[model samples]
Target: MTVIKGCRLICPNNTHDPILIPDREPVYVGRSEATRCIDPRCSRKQLEVIADWESGEVTVRQLGLNSSAIDGIELEKDRKCKLPKGGTIYLLVGMYPQRVEFTYKESPKSPSSPKTENSEKKNKEKKEALKRPASDHTSSNPKVKKPRISSVQGSKSHEIENGSADKAVEEDEEDIKQLEEKLKILKKNAAEKKFAFSSDSEGLLADNEQKKMTSSGKGKRGGGETSGSSLSKTLSDGSSLKKTSAGSCKSPATKSSSAGSDSLNRSAKESEGPPATETKWQPFEKLYVCTRKGVRARDKIAGFDIDGTIITTQSGKTFPTHSGDWRILYPEIPGRLKKLHADGYKIVFFTNQLGVSKGKTTIEDLKTKFGSVLDKLGVPAQILISTGGGMYRKPAQGMWDFLCQKANDGIKVNIDDSLYVGDAAGRPEKWATKKKKDFSCSDRLFAMNIGVKFYTPEEFFMFQKTAPFSLPEFDPRATVSARIVDPPSASLTSKSQEVVVLVGFPACGKSFFSKTHMIPKGYVHVNRDTLGSWKKCVDVCAKALREGQSVVIDNTNPDKESRQRYTNCAKTAKVPCRCFFFTATITQARHNERYREMIDKSHQPINDMIMNTFKSKLKVPELSEGFTEILRINFVPKFKDSKNERLYKQYLLEK
Candidate 1:
């Protein structure tokens, strides 16, 4: 028998030809046509396999975003493991399994250790036993028990005594089919190699040479039967085979074959597919919440984001191609979640799915997708999904608040022990190898708003050191006050009638400042929102000034042209025009707007379009824009109640 040198990688489902592992060199395996791996989640260079013939081992390194496994042990990205002669390697969470097989030449036996008469006689008897029919051998063996299918209640009693015979039979048949497929493959390769020789005489000469070497070498190692014949006999007696505790099917003569490799063990169940989950998710206010069976609300909470954190698109896409297009982000996720559950921490997944509100995906589909993920994790958990923007969306503590206040069954959460893990931590591009910049900082901000510790997915799952990240410039937690006006002696009102135009972005405290400070001083308030248009506001301002009263224009007079309108009005009315330029940034205004939405539901939500439009048109109110005086008005937030003040201090922008 000829022994092939080095290791061979055989992906039974993906390719018929085995890939030869080059000695001391890395061979890349992935979705590339060369590797013949069609799994979409497999990257072009998903795995790096380095074979060492001298050591009889292979070094495998994970290089892709998804995870691979070696003999059931997880091999994560940038991590490597040494695999022995016959070990199975799984790509993308136990899919596309390829077994590495190391081949070696059998040492020849010495003629001085010739077989004795007794050993020769035993060998002849073993050959005769192999030629006997399997049925006759089974009937002759006293230890083998025949299945009893009786009439009346005897059949039911027999089933209760020995378990389901039909299931056992089905498993045996399946195992036999797999074994036959391997045998056929081996035969096909052997026949191809046999014909490749120059001539029949050369092939015959090689066979005679092998026989002489075997006769002159070490004694027969096993039952002296070829693997092909041994496998055929095993399949013929498949009905008598029993599953061992290790989940392998074996017969008494199974040890005769030297071909007991990892490929046979590949039939071990890797995944049973996603478990069927019931739709138990219920709507709580604006959040879609689901508590898996056996989950309990605990003091310590382990919160995670659904997308990019727990699971990712199996298609290697940013967005999923379908509802079922997803896989566990890392192989360690399930084990870690289980550990957290054992530590009395309630597992929770917080996700913002604005597309649900926009009709991109249905709520039922999201529920199914989430259910599949939870099922794969095999742990009891709770999921909170925010379908639309508002309090429930991340960067707002609405979901956290609801979990503590409404859900949790009245149990108080210990913020000190609770921490959130997500991918969107405001990390810049190249924060890690091949890591892209996060789309938003909502996860980090959500943890900040809930006053709990936060961690990115890499830090939590991979146990990596904290990476550098930036937060939004506007810190709502800061309570120290700054100067209300740029000039220390700037007065709120003048003794003579004057036109005061508030120049700032919307929600920058322009309306509040005019109503609180100017309106009570006999100055007529003018607003575009109230009067409908800028023309109407101008008319109202001119009318108030014509009556010898001071007018306060509370509108976002952003550009020089808009501020010129009010300044021209003051000039025509023979009064001084002053610009109260509000020095508030766009981020601060956005934070204030969201705070208002939370406190007052009637306050219309200001979208990014409105804020961006104001920013684009802004030219910075200047003394050159025909103003008698230009005073900078700083935004100083005030709260009526202590609860409102607490809420105001929480982060509101996603950034």
Candidate 2:
């Protein structure tokens, strides 16, 4: 045998580089002789191998190139020939003469095996058996014979005696028919049971049909009868049933059809029972108002005054007073009263009417007129009238006490929270002044003295409608206390660092005071005129306060009601508040010479009449009632002297 080593071959078509195998096992086989052969038809390059008997040598037959254009080549060296390209290379191992001869032999054919032949025969037999007809159970016989038990019960025996075959066939057929009938009955019973259990009969029917198709032969007639009886019992016990004559009509279609009829009859028998009842409300039930203190107050009592308060008389004929007449509810008044009601404040018109005793108006007529006025005003509550009596009249507190006793049934008022609003004294012209008539009546004064918080119509209206006062909650006691503690002064800087509100007639030194005093003293000046230019000035002021800045409002805050807004704002910001009234006398105001200049320079025309009206209506800041501080500004000589710095310093220091 010859072996080849260290031989290489390369093919042009092979894209991947070949792996070089060194020290690989060589293979040898017997051959007749060693021959030199070339296959030109082969696409692979030809390589040659030569054998040497002496020294066990193998040589390359032709090309000795290290690399070749050939696709693959075989080589052998020493013991056996090696073709690295071939998966397994062959070598001739038998001994041969120096001149060896080669010969080729043909391969022999293989004989058939018995197992294969037997399997083929078995398959042919199976095909023939499948092509044959099925066996028949019936035979031609007049007599009805009994069925062979083995044949009917699926036995392995295939044949029966001719005498008994006919009987066996007949018996088998009868058994099949019975089984089918039982299956149908079982199916019907299952359907009825399913329908009884389901809320929807239509769905139950569909499910039953599907079940029957899937479980055709498994159902039994006896099982169906038992299931049907159970279903009937369920339906008869007040369970829902199809109520119709159709339900009661049993068809031979199913055994449960008759049971359904019996259930329907039972349901009809139970339908004769009595029905259920309903409820109603009791008489003498009433709605009452109760305080957080557990005090129950009167529901509808309202008191009215007779004099200039409720009735205004032109000459002799009596008519409703502007302040007294409920007919002409001020635009801002209704909304305010509604808000008070929403906050649980009972709205009762408390007034002292003495005209009945004076014989100016009869009690009956007055009541009728008052009732008409209240109706016109849409006052839905009841009215309590106290007339003629001296004790129950103005400045006496008798009338309020009487009404309270009657309405409250002796329940004392939490006086601190109650409010009294009226126009004038019990006698209107009694307190009239030379320059102006006193709108505050004696009754009003009495109410005020008795500690009832009094507010004029204008004051109440303004406070109710505007910001700050429009806040959802307020405590008058705290407000009055704060006002009494820190009275207003001309000096901007107070120990409390309170917010000062400048209020008076338009252009009546409000803005001037704010800019001249408040701003210079590190007080924040919040002018409504400036704020009015922007939509959300109050919000801006609130923000500044949140950041710890005190604010002063510059506005025509003529009424106590208007001033209340600023006071309330101060309260909300947890800051003290004061009111500064620019109380310049008419003489000084007209002669100052600056007034005309201001009027001329003003963008809005200042009507003198309107200005005077506003000034006259300006309510003095009620420091004892609802304000932290109140200051009166008077015009003194040298009020504007540029060199009187000492006097200015003195005023500032004293304030």
Candidate 3:
């Protein structure tokens, strides 16, 4: 790999100095105190070169350059890129071309393998042949030695040293016009070549035109490939699209000679479909819809979670305060999506932003930011944002169901090809950003609900296998059919009038079971949600017991203290109190909550805090808690007319 030795600052009276682009930290280039380079001629923190130390992949971004005059870096195009090895990338600070040169060097260790030894032999010969003539030219010139020595260090600095021998490229006023014309032609040809070879493979190949980049800057042959490449939405169709250098989306009409052409053709066949229905703010269950204008509904859908998956704050903080404080997380994200779009997958973004409903951020601001983000991404996509909590919130399939049934022009999604990727994968704390656990296991549950494959942002974007996700304890997938809990021949007496104290989490099937089975058996129902207090609930139960009628207390009697009041009331009435323990797991309870909230408008949404509270305070019920009879009530699946064994299906869509 080629290494950059120094940067030439083209300011009057300033001697040439070495500017090393170090790895990892953001190497600031300008007149700021914090910047690595302090050039009075350059603006404060005008440009930043972010480098990965190991691979030497450098991405240069403009921070506060006030002018459009800068040539290599473009604010409009977001021209930050991985700097090619063995080449010079010219960025204009004011009007002069700031040359960053990669110098060839001999490693201390000899090559081990025969192939490597042979390759190294060829490289050494090539370097010698190029340098052999240059040494004579510079020795005769004499003037090149001092300027080059001060500007670059080590044995490799000789080649870079020869270029500044005239001491005129950076400071000579007379050569400015000549340099400007030459630089213009070079930049134009380079831009054209970059546009033609769009992918990372082609980007490296674009260096072939380096001979024309600058008549002064010499080109060296470098052997390598992009060391790291990473993911979202699994693509099994064997379809792909070649991205352009400017990273613009080409109509499926543009054919590429690259290998991706086969994938692109395959994608066109997959994407062929009726036009998708385009609508913004199409209301559904207190949620708003916004589909990208030109997107079409296809059999295969590539769903993504927006914020942490697609974009992150440029500030490097976990959360962004302003709408504009965001950037595309990975460059591969755009390229991959463009390919997917070309291949025929309907790309959709499903995001939940509670801040919108809480007035921390406005709907208009979020929508505007989203529009700009998509515009910057330059891909057509359907968007579903659940601003308020309920069925539309992730972990529930309300948004997915809506997209499949209503938004997609009546095309049923193929779950085999469909996949979802999100950052809220219930991962351990600080999985992506420091000091941040995933907000919930909602994304995984969302995919599970819709019967599709799931992936975390790290898995999808960076192609990394993270530690096993800490899944929601209340996964409905594991909670199967509910078993009927028959009493041990004691509580089945038809004339017995007893108080049944139900026990479980908030969303447990206590109330549902009470209404469906217990009510039919002449048991009067009493609940805290309906009566407003447990005291009132106990009073209602007492009134019912006094009337010689059975009563079911349908509140989450989580611990001994909460259950004590109800048990004591029944004992005072001289009735044999029955403890009906609803044996639904947390997963089953959460599944029931999600289903009820989305399907039935009359049903209130179950808060996470309430569920957590019950989970935290829960104590195992014993016969010691003053009960004559204890019956284990296993969750029994109930559907109005559907017979699908998958209970989650009832809440999602009509089978």
Evaluate residue 361 in candidate 2 and report its C-alpha lDDT on the 0 to 100 scale: 44
- Please provide the root mean square deviation of candidate 2 (C-alpha atoms, Å): 45.8
* Residue-by-residue lDDT tens digits, candidate 1, 1-655: 3444768888857564688888888998888666667867778889999888777778899899876766434565786777644667777544577878777885575454345765676577555544454444343422223456566655667876456544554554455456667878887545433311113421222344334334544212111322333223333432333434323234443455324322222221111112215435666434678878777756678999989999899999999999999999999999999998887788889999877654477666987888888889999888988876667889888898888877676555767778999988999888989988889888998998887789988899999999989999999898646678879699989989999989898899998998889999999999988999999999998899889999999999889888888899998988999989998899999988988987885476688899999999998888887788889899998889998988788888887
Tens digit of per-residue lDDT, candidate 2, span 24-44: 222121221221212232212
lDDT of 3 by residue, 1-655 (tens): 4444433233222334546655566766655433333444456666676656445466666565442122222232244545444323333322333434434454466448998887777677544533333334333422223454544455567656656654543333333445556778887545543312225522232334433323323222111111111001111232343343222223333243333433332332333455545535553433567877787877778999888889999898878979999999888899888988888788999988767544466556878899988998888888888766566777667788778778776555667777899876767765655647666677776887777888877788788876466654444445555456755454532367777788897777777778887889998889888799977987888888888898888888889998888789878888877787777766567667767765564465676788788889989788899987788877766666553344355333110
Give stretches of model 1 more than 4 Å off.
1-279, 480-482
Clashes by residue pair, model 3: 144-165, 231-460, 231-461, 232-460, 267-343, 271-344, 430-436, 474-587, 482-635
Q: What TM-score does prediction 2 earn?
A: 0.23
For candidate 2, the lDDT comes to 0.42
Judging by TM-score against the true structure, name the best candidate. Answer: 1
lDDT of 2 at 373: 51
Identify the runs in model 3 with alpha carbons over 4 angstroms from their true place.
Answer: 1-271, 274-285, 410-412, 430-436, 479-482, 486-494, 524-551, 558-575, 585-587, 613-617, 643-655
Scored by CA lDDT, what does every candidate get? 0.75, 0.42, 0.63
Measured over all alpha carbons after superposition, the RMSD of each candidate to the real structure, in angstroms, is 28.4, 45.8, 25.4
Query: Of the pair 1 and 2, which is ahead by lDDT?
Result: 1
Judge candidate 1 at residue 461 and give its lDDT: 92
Clashes of each: 5, 28, 9
